[model samples]
Target chain A: MELKGRAHKFGNDVNTDYIISGRHKFKTLDMNELAKYVMEDLDPDFYSKITSGDFIVAGSNFGCGSSREQAPQAIKCAGIGAVLAKSFARIFYRNAINIGLPVVECDTDAISAGDELAVDLSKGIIKNLTQGREIAVKPLPEVMITILNDGGLPAHFRKHGTFNL
Target chain B: MGKTIAEKILSRHSGTETYANEIAVAGLDFVMGQDGTSPLAIRAFNDMGGEKVFDSSKIAMVIDHSAPSPLEGVSALHKLMREFAADKGIKLYDIGCGVCHQLMPEQGHVVSGDLVIGADSHTCSYGAINVFSTGVGSTDLAAGMISGKLWFKVPETFKFQINGKLGRGVYSKDLILYLIGDVTADGATYMAAEYVGEAIDNLSVEARFTISNMAIEMGAKAGLMRADAKTEAWLKAHSDRVSQPVEADPDAVYAKVKEYDASRIGPQVARPHTVDNVSPIEEVEGTLIQQAMLGTCTNGRLEDLIIAAEIVRGKKISPDVRFIVAPSSRQVYLEAMNRGVIQALVEAGAAVVTPGCGPCVGTHNGVPSDGENVISTANRNFKGRMGNNRAFVYLGSPATVAASALNGKITDPRRYVR
Candidate 1:
């Protein structure tokens, strides 16, 4: 899948609470509405500008903190094609993959928004569509690849009844 | 040719002696969850063409978030889950039982060596009693609802050996907070921790639970210790099943070993926004506190209350502070009441609530207003987790939280020591 957009970069440990203050959960009824305020609390202009297919590239430990499922749901629902961080919090990583959100972990570099990038899961490469630059990331392992391609664990199971161990 | 207790449990429920840190696939034995993810997962389940669960007995749900629902959807989610469970013949618990993991063991649903998967990250809490537990995604949970199985990765084990008794004012929460400081946030990624020490054997199940519950903060697959007499006693009172224990063999191999001296420990707190940003309770003194909550699956046990009650027995909470104590279970609640500890707490101006993982999940009842500062006995105090983005949450022991409640600021427990 190709995602063409500016890359918005963040440092390591960009936690779930920073994306959406858990306190504001009271104000919003559903996750769809909540996605509008994603990352708005940390950066006020984040909600208005963030568009579809924009990759969120981070340094390390992206999506740290409470196991709030909304953290990933909001990000994926907002149409992020892939989240390529140096690393991910355990819960956030699982939550993203389970929700069918494309999340990859790659080496840290100077990839920023407006550098339109195309993510090739097959070739394990992230091509900067705008800058015409390309960076390679490790391909997803076979099992995880199955989960991602199948559109999350639930969908995968639905398509293929329990994979015999 | 060989296996540890965790390896044996994982293998039994997963791939046959498979790849390192990887599992092939297998059926699920138990699925557990709290209020945070169940509602939305059920919604997703319906949206995803998921009809019925594979089996009702294989699933268990609890309302630990928002014991009183600090907000609407979360509360409605709990109510919806209750109705759904009742409608589907699924076993469900409200604030009536306590936190998911607490009630899990209390209700005899999660036995030692059982493979339990939960929607909440802290589902690893079951590992303290030797269960091979892991946290799963909500959608995966929905799929597991209909299909009674899930996959897992074999986890490397990190063994923490403890020696010496804790010094005055230090407790298990402090020990975990200290470990976070030493190891950093991503220290134990994909690693299960097994505690082995004289101190570990001597501690109560509740204290051990506190340790295991926070394993995620260290990026661990799960934290655990061999079940001992303390676990047996706790199970006898809570579980109706014939008791069994899961312990590590004397020759079990571990990935890494870390050691700590308990006597050198002091009460510590995880500063806002990160569990690893730990500092001594004395260092953060005068950190203006607006709320002090003393309870959760992490620190809401009876011993935690006893420590809080002793601190607040005669002193009154500051008028400026909102102090809430939430026990983790009905049994803990009843136990606290029968011991006259409840009277001391109530007299000290603390509002007591039911047993569950309330407030800590950022649910209402103790949500701090904007610009407020919170000192809590719960886990995780990331920005905006309380009520407002401006609100600050500082994690501490019951002793620190209790003292902070009395003074309305982040005061160390040392000053309150008699």
Candidate 2:
């Protein structure tokens, strides 16, 4: 798949609590509602600053601590096209893919906030349109690509059938 | 080809040969969700037109994250879980039941050779007992609930060979902290960790549980130990089910192997804001603390409480410190009480709370205010995890917490232990 977006930057170890603090969880579970509070603790004006098709570029362990899938759901519903991080916590990585949120493990050091970029997952290329540079990233396996193509496991299950042993 | 412990268990459940990094479906032996995650799982399950649970007997919901509902929203979520449990006939563990990780093993919901999954990241705690337990998202858990099976990309195993006897001050918590500090948080992402060697073999099941429980700190998919006589005995004592333990093949190939000298390790702690930001206890000694929490699935068992009680026996906590003790489960609480551990702690000015995950998620009971320093036995020292973002949390062993409670500063646990 081909995608283009502006980068939204975050630092290393941007944990689940910072993604969407548990304090707001008491108020609602609505994805959009939770989206409104994403990264509010880190940057109060995060929601106002974001637009559809924006991508998040973060340092290592982007979704560390806590197993709240709400963290990824909020990010995906907030209109993020994809997330490129140095690494991810295992559970958060799985949670993101299960919810059809495209997360890439790539060296995001050269990417800056608001930098225009085009990513071609099919070609394993992340083109920095603003800087005129292209970086290679590992593409998702076919099984995962198929799941993401169907908009996550739920939709995939609806189409194919439940996986049973 | 021989298989690692994780691969063996996955292969067994998948009813086919499995290899590292290969995607396969395995039947689940137990699937669980807590109050925080169950609401979302239930929502996903309902959205998928799930009329009944795949197997109610094998499914469970624990209300421990925000037990007794500190907030109205949490209570509302609890209500939803209660209704769902009743309607689906799934096992329900209500408020004060204890942390899901501790309660699962104590109640025999998880056993050796089982493929268990839960919505809580710490669900990997069951790996201490030789089970292939891993964490999943709510939707993944929902799918597991509906289909009794889940997908996995079998992880390569990192074999950890531990040798040397533990020093007087050293404990499982300290050893795990040292390991995590060396490896960093993302070092083991998407991999299985198989702990072996004389030191691991000599450790108690509780201590092993503590080690395996913190594997997630290094981003491991699961921390596993081979099922030996100790595992079989523990399972026989705790579970009524007759099942064979799973073991790795004699020549199982490991992705990587590393060795450590356990005796060289001293008391350790994870400094504020991140679990892998670790230091020797001496480096952070004398740092003042306002709260000392001794509980959670990590160190809330009977052995841990006894260790705390032994330190606090006939002693008083600092006037500036608020020492809180939370037993892991009702069974643990009752056992400690019967053994006089509760009396020792309470007599030393420690507040004994309900047998649940109190103050771990920052939801209820003993949350630290801004600028407050807290020493705790629970895992995860992330910013704002214990309520205020400004509060500094230091992760340590129960003995370390107890010793620090007495002095209102981080003190060496060895002094008290000796």
Best by lDDT: 2
TM-score of chain A by itself in each prediction:
0.89, 0.92
Model 2: per-residue Cα lDDT over B1-418, one tens digit each: 9999899999999999999999888999999999878999888887767787889999999998887787777788899999999999999999988889988888988888899999988888888888999989899999999999998999999888999989896889999999999988887888999888888898899889999999988889899987778888888888887665777888888888899999999999899888999999999999999999999989999999999999999999999999999999999999998999999999999998887775887888888998999999999888888877789999999999999999999999998887
Residues B56-103, candidate 1: write the lDDT tens digits. Answer: 987988876667565555667777889878876899887667888778
lDDT of 2 by residue, A58-143 (tens): 99989987789999999988888889998888789878988888898888998988899898766788999998898779667677
Best by TM-score: 2
For every prediction, compared with the true complex, DockQ reads: 0.55, 0.64
TM-score, chain B, predicted structure 1: 0.93
Write down the TM-score of every candidate: 0.94, 0.97
- Candidate 1, residues A21-53: lDDT per residue as tens digits? 665543344777878878875777776677887
Q: Kindly report which residue stretches of model 2 are placed more than 4 angstroms away from their true locations once superposed.
A: A121-124
Poorest 10 consecutive residues of model 2 chain A by lDDT?
A: A156-165
Candidate 2, TM-score vs. the true structure? 0.97
Worst 10 residues of 1 chain B by lDDT: B18-27
**lDDT against the true structure, each candidate:** 0.78, 0.88
Best by DockQ: 2
